[model samples]
Target: MNHLSRRAFLQGSALAVSAGAVSRIAAASLPEAVTQTQAGTQPPLTPASGRPYQPVVTLNGWTLPWRMNKGVKEFHLVAEPVLREIAPGMKANLWGYNGQSPGPTIEVVEGDRVRIFVTNKLPEHTSVHWHGQRLPNGMDGVTGLTQPGIKPGKTFVYEFTARRAGTFMYHPHADEMVQMAMGMMGFWITHPKDPSFMRVDRDFVFLLNAYDIEPGAATPRVNEMTDFNLWTWNSRAFPGIDPLVVRQHDRVRIRIGNLTMTNHPIHLHGHEFVVTGTDGGWTPPAGRWPEVSADIAVGQMRAIEFDASEPGDWALHCHKSHHTMNAMGHEVPTMIGVDQSSELKKISQLIPDYMVMGDKGGSMGEMEMPLPDNTLPMMGGQGPYGSLEMGGMFSVVKVRAGLARNDYRDPGWYRAPAGSVAYEWQGAAAYLPSAGGSRPAAPAASPSSKETVVNVVKPAAHKH
Candidate 1:
């Protein structure tokens, strides 16, 4: 191969590193999708009030005997009383991990041994189980099946080697259904030993699950899988959770785990991800493969890495359509069929802002309410009045910096960058149209014109 071709090949190989690395291609290598979009002078938005993005991290809490730190982390399971208007202002107890439902994201490195000390803060006995970790049977954290449950206030530590790198999860093993249902799950990501294999521009962790809420209430109802009411990422439903931020040309790594007793086949538009790791362990690079969607089973975790090289806002959600919305659509009927269908439609048409997000591609309705009953109030305590709303959960991953305008579009058909106001894309495409339109008109060639006569008179023959 010639020098130029050899250099090109090497560059392409670098872009394929499992870790987060931007893929830089010559303008000529630009895909047809990219060439169609035009670049604008403005940059994407940078919110002033927004919190600095924190990578989602998960830790395991289990009780075991033998090695140091036991095998678990301080996995605190608590049941707290919460007030729900639907329950007539009565307080009901909800279960959670580390005092919060949807648990926490635990991060570690591949091949590193982990020692977690778990303390049961709740009234009942519970144990932590490392979901998808292939360890000695004794250190698995199974309650009656693996070891005795840890009594309240007592701490148990479980230790084990994280053989592979991928998305893994942790939850209470005792009364698996009840405990997990009340929000006892979280996410984990294992990084590779060598930084080269782990370098990434951006990394995100998503813990997706659903909750059943009693009608017109703020609290979550317990254990109704058939009638699951709300879907959430990292415990906060859409609208309530914040957008995942990113820069254009960034490489992103996302680890998804399902603790909601259902399988979530996640889908992302624009670019595909490489399934570099699985629950069993990290697959050898030669065996690693690429895919656009993946089915992550309950109590299961999977790791995927992709290039955010494409700009614009991309939609990342569960393939199961219902999983994108609250337990159900609004109790009230649509305007077209309701008592004031005409009025509602008119108001929606005239006032853009008044119309709630009707049944669109998916329902991020629950995001308008408070965190689930099983979730801890602390993590959800950021927004005013300590409540999380849309624009808080299920965040938009900004590929590049600067204010996102309609004109600056990535090759990917990402929705327009989210506006400062909430729910601007209620009916419009995910991204806002560029200042003029999707494709900017090439600058009209300067009109042809005759040259002007020389106006500059020689400086009086220069009096020297």
Candidate 2:
């Protein structure tokens, strides 16, 4: 039944009845709820049965597949407790829809009528709020205000027409704080009616989410507020987060939604872009300004467009330094520039695992310290040169030329032209004279002239 086409599945429904109101159908005839188990960035799900439009790539996530029935696009989401791998070695017990945390992205057209059936499997009540949508009041999904909470084992239906062409999000409005902390959220994109409107060669979408899972623990602290631990993009930390692959000179648009408690100043390297859209709607041509970064605040969505003009593995990450680090390192005491050799030896006698950290700018990315089970080093990711020393909310935008139009595969590392890469200087450390000519040494003035001049120059040190 899961693999059946929309027509076939609807025809084979167990309790098929007259289609007076599709939303009122018996549970036995509900649309199949497709779920995903693999924790990877799935290929964009192209429209198999609806108005044709460009689909978006969800970073480390996938879009929900819907069935078209009677001109309505239908989707089923199952809410339940699930295990979500935050990265390669760490898994968290979270509650999400259709299998993963920060659930599968939902994509729709601007004027499409959408019918979503939600089946609750969690112990508590839940309701999906279509954030930043223009919809009927009764379908708003706020518990006790618009609709009652969907109790465990109960299925609820929400039908609405997507009236806006913009970016949006969906999350629980019932027990909002706790459920969101448990990762019950997802991305939504209502593409414009015209496929060419604001079209780009590549479009990528993801959400900023965080958790308060303690080291060696698998469940988030639902009550924690500002003291969160795992800062993630689409529930994945750096290294575990896949790169945004684009063909060179492609028109690229990245839609980002912030569901975390705080804001994230997302920065991109090697290229500049402009804000093409936001939660409210697409920006007019006059309103857009070129920028390399955008600060997305809580409950906000932003779509930035850029041309992948350069070919390289350019960095794209959050500007907040701590937001780019993993859990344990956040609370560690500052030990930079401190000599702890003798102290570490004394402490090692009592605690055999004692080790010096951050002295002489030590990086946890290169440390071999044994960590508690199910945790990540604060700053750890491998790059072509050496340790990236980065974690959380970071990834590379690999722009390469000659790639297939639709290809999103990692192009591996970029190969720079001869002498293009920065290298250790083999020449003198002192500044050299300008190529035109060494200016005559500043003329010396006699004491009686009341002024004397001397030239001083400083060499610059470049770091990547």
- The lDDT of each candidate is 0.49, 0.82
Error of 1 at 384 (Å): 22
Q: In candidate 2, what are the lDDT values of residues 131-231, reduced to their tens digit?
A: 99999999999999999999999999999999989999999999977899999999989998999998899999999999988877899999988888789
TM-score of decoy 2: 0.87
Q: Which residue segments of model 2 deviate by more than 4 Å?
A: 1-28, 329-331, 429-464
**Candidate closest to the true structure, highest TM-score:** 2
**What's the distance in Å from true for residue 147, model 1?**
0.9
RMSD (Å) of each candidate, 1 decimal = 20.9, 12.1
Clashing pairs in 2: none
lDDT of 1 at 335: 36
Q: List model 1 lDDT by residue over 187-260, tens digit each.
A: 56555666566566555565766666663355556656666656666555543443455666666677666777
